[model samples]
Target: EPEVTQTPSHQVTQMGQEVILRCVPISNHLYFYWYRQILGQKVEFLVSFYNNEISEKSEIFDDQFSVERPDGSNFTLKIRSTKLEDSAMYFCASSRTGRTGELFFGEGSRLTVL
Candidate 1:
């Protein structure tokens, strides 16, 4: 079965820097999102995109965060400025539809801001 794929399984960056985490969701799924989870905390929703636009976002998704679906295939999350609090496992997930479909999640990209 097709699955979401993320690059640079682990990334280490300095605080106040920029970081881009990339992902390719399942081809047929439409709704996409980025989620963050600290080592032992519950998952935190960052943003969700559908129909080529942002559907919803959380307060945590501030000016420092942005999402893009540049090529109709690859979806990316760019943190214009990374902070220590940004260190976490960022997961990429998708659903066939925005509401009722089960979400499929990528293994996740680990971002470590020093």
Candidate 2:
């Protein structure tokens, strides 16, 4: 079966530092998305990419954040500056179709900022 894979399952960083979270989605999947959940908060959508461009994004995805598909095989999210409030569990997901279809999610990449 195909599944999403994330690297550095857990990351610790200091405020004002930068972090790049990496993910590899299912090979045949077309839609990719990044979401995050603060320690005790609800999961929030960050951004969605398709066809080598951003398809959708939430207010949480500000100038400090950016995403890329460097090699067509891996998708990455870069946070230019980390903040204490940025600590959260980030999830990578993909689906054969768009939002109307089922999504497969990676375990999660936990980010901790001090």
State the lDDT at 110 in candidate 2. 99
Candidate 2 residue 64 C-alpha distance from true site, Å: 0.4
Worst 10 residues of 2 by lDDT: 95-104
Work out how many backbone clashes candidate 2 has. 0
lDDT of 1: 0.93
What's model 1's TM-score? 0.97
Error of 1 at 101 (Å): 5.1
C-alpha TM-score for every candidate: 0.97, 0.96
lDDT of 2 by residue, 26-74 (tens): 9999999999998888989999999999999999999999999999799
lDDT of 1 at 85: 90
